[model samples]
Target: MTDVPGFPPHTQLLAALARLGQATRMDAVRNAGPHNLSPLQADIVGLFRRGAAVLRQSDIVTALASTAPTISDAVRVLRRKGLVDATADLADARARLLVLTPAGEAEAERLTAFSDGLVEAVDTLPEQDLAAILRAGTRLMRELESRNLIPMSRMCPTCRFFVPDAHPGEVRSYHCDFVDAPFGAAELRVTCPDHEVRD
Candidate 1:
């Protein structure tokens, strides 16, 4: 579907991904708008899903691929809303760690399932398509991280436990030392709590 004449094949794929991202953003708006929170604000809350993440304003800027001023402004708004609090980082006196309040944690948990509709839509695709998309997405993420265009993601390719193509002839080729199990491309995780940096 390379509708853009004279363009490379990747252009079409990138365009398709952008469309999907737009759809997801609209869904985020529908869920966060009523609560007086923007999509980005909701995402900020969601970042604490693993636990009380010891994150600073700069860390959030990197994580979201946003500018420091933008994140700082957003943090100020969040603090005013009582959804988040910035406290002194025990390890670094000069840095302030962003923490979600009880209400903020509740909001974060709620936001986790905001993409349920998107997930259901994806589930409609055939297994082959799903696997292909997962592989492409993982590769794209890796490239972006390598270029520092995006922060390192908790995907299989960047994990200490990942062993790619460990079982070439098997249905599940990749190996994960963390669980001592083999998984296919479709099982690749984009944000895993158990992820450990490869280097």
Candidate 2:
């Protein structure tokens, strides 16, 4: 979409982001095309690939920020494709846990690297741009997630241990109570595996 000349700066920025998002989806579709997987199926597989345990249908729905029926249908398709298997959870006799077959795991591995080329392209950008992207991305994710517009992320800003600009003029500005240390933007985590969400 072309940017409107008279549009405000924020509007223009959002438009650019929307274009990037569309491009990302297009890339995902293209990458998964050879595997005969839709973008959603690929995403599901990727999620499972990252996880160590089986996931419930509801877990898939919540993680993808999708509806129950939608995830159910996708799971059915995946099962039909022989990519996923369902088993009863020991903890809950009625709950069915979804696990990937060997073929599914292989496909998941492929899907995991779909954006590696994009990451290398992004690495060619300036350090300042990279820092700005990390800050802005986490802020936007936090804002959207607060309104339940998207899935939750473990961002430093919303983490209980995070302290912004703890040292005003110091090179290492932000503070992490978890580690009891200050860090610069380069070290700021947009998606911290150890982050605990602030209550």
Task: Give stretches of model 1 more than 4 Å off.
Answer: 1-6, 50-52
Top of the candidates by TM-score: 1
Clashing pairs in 2: none
List, residue by residue over 54-166, the lDDT tens digit for candidate 2.
89988899988999999999999999999999999898887799999998988887876647667777779888787778778888888999899988866788889999979
lDDT of 1 by residue, 51-129 (tens): 2366788778877889988988888898998889988888889889999888887787788785777889988998878
Error of 2 at 94 (Å): 4.1
Q: How far out, in Å, is residue 176 in model 2?
A: 6.6
Off by over 4 Å in 2: 1-5, 91-94, 115-117, 159-183, 187-189, 192-196
